[model samples]
Target: MQTPEQVAAAFDLLADQHDAMRWDLALSEFDASVLASLEGIATANVASSALFLAGGSGREALSFVMHGWKCDLVELSRRMLELAECRLHKFDLRIVESEAARYLADTTEKYDFISMVGELVGYVQEPRSILRAAALRLRPDGLIAVTWVDSSSLAATRQTEEQGVVALVERDDLEIRAWTCETMQKYVDAARLTVVLRSGRMAESPRRFWILRKEM
Candidate 1:
């Protein structure tokens, strides 16, 4: 469980290498697939507005912006937002440099969709609180997408010796908590959000994504 400041510092330090490192991990493809699935749901639901939590470098939200969806991205790292600004200059994208939970707490605006992509929820110390706040900002039929690493996988087993915290970029001093899919599911269920879609595999790396909707 990392604090907002700690999470921000870690990401700020990695901002420059973030894109390259993520690309190496095949995260871009995974994100694209997630976006494609979300797009289908959005189209079916006639959703036009979105709130993206921990939207790093704004890649995942770029298509939504191009599709004329009103998009607001909440990211903790100023450097990441700077990069996003550079790439998304033509669009009126609202980029907020704040912790996702805090930003959601302060906003009264609701959206047709909200996404916490790339396992961002895993880094939070209190994911349930974030989910609760997100639920408040979600429209009645809107969807919330969350992704995380599954704890029951071989990857999680290997990380157990390190207590689920991994050092960033091989820097032994800085580490972030690695959350499990079960733990994330608990939080989402506690927030009273229903799981509408589930995807991903649990073998070695074990990444999982879920699409949730607030119960009427």
Candidate 2:
């Protein structure tokens, strides 16, 4: 319900706070679950493949790569990219200072893995559009990971409107468009992908994460 720019600015500040929430065990549950659920794909196989992280500002997913997996991140901010680089300097990470959906939709490039995290999912009106688009960027048998807010989750009940930045979000019914695990399935089902993994609701904030693989 907040302006995209306002939300981005607020998150940028939070990124500086400690990034504690980003790496929380519950936070990684979505990622960990998706990784575990995929039985056909070898863990190392997906990890070693090329990855596109739409809306990967601040490079939280980059840590996933350096710490365990191996993949590149796509972000929309130069400043965020710089910070990500600083934190993930040891890996073979590459970045693009543009929106992930924009890049995948406009370019001929394809990846073996794609992670649509935080800002991208947290702010889109059509989160599925990004997932469908990301699916296009994947080669056959490639995997796409998507995370988004679960609008129906009771988690939001405790988050008073006053907690976010002042006027941080708009009060439009548009928030109803948020994608939860239940609804997100429709998107993946509609897309030309096979749902391989899915997870959500690890914390008070209800966010859904899905892992899909392009059919062979």
Candidate 3:
């Protein structure tokens, strides 16, 4: 299992090529899905604040900042955060270089909108705990847009399972934990979050996208 720092190192190695991939929609389904979901959240309620966890290269934060939302982006990789700063320097974005879990633990401020997309959850050691922590930082009516990896979807060389949690090893430096939709929903329930929007329930895809609201 790779620690958060190890994962950050792996991402740092990919930083040079990451921004290019983000700009190309055809190659970036994750960005497209997240942006489309953001539009939905924007239409229903005009969110004034947003927090992006594991936000890479400022593409998502860029959209929120452009619309005048006070944006704070927390990224683990130094290289990635540097690139994000270059893109977001014009805006008053609070870009921080810290692991998402630690930031959530230390920050007392709450947000109206929070996004934990990319491999934020999968790369973490305690996925459920992180989700619960994010929920605690959300305002009552706030929305959380996130994505999770499906355990069965990866073509990993070796895999391990324990109590429904699966660790997928694709390469020496590339390892991610995954969970089934049912298992992930269980985590959401435990966190007191309700899923308002789900991309799909099918197991065909490796990643699952969801928009959650703190349960009243």
Quantify all predictions' global Cα lDDT against the true fold: 0.73, 0.57, 0.83
Q: Between prediction 2 and prediction 3, which has the larger TM-score? A: 3
Q: Which regions of candidate 3 deviate over 4 angstroms?
A: 28-30, 155-161, 200-204
Report the Cα lDDT for candidate 2.
Answer: 0.57
What ranges in model 1 sit over 4 Å off?
20-29, 42-47, 154-174, 178-182, 202-204
My TM-score estimates for the predictions, one after another, are 0.82, 0.69, 0.91
> Tens digits of per-residue lDDT for model 1 on 1-216?
346787777778788788555434565555556768866764565538899899888877766787788899999888888888877879868988888878888888989888888777667666568888899898887888888765554343124233434322224324434555566667787888999888876333456779999876
Q: Write the per-residue lDDT of candidate 3 for residues 63-177, one digit (tens) a residue.
A: 6887788889999899999999888899979998999999999999899999897858888888889999999999997889888887756555445555777777755787878
Worst 10 residues of 3 by lDDT: 23-32
Off by over 4 Å in 2: 1-7, 18-20, 23-43, 46-48, 54-70, 155-177, 180-182, 201-205
Candidate 1, pairs of clashing residues: none
Give the distance in Å from residue 53's predicted Cα in candidate 2 to where it truly belongs.
2.3
Steric clash pairs (candidate 3): none
Residue 143 C-alpha lDDT in model 3: 87
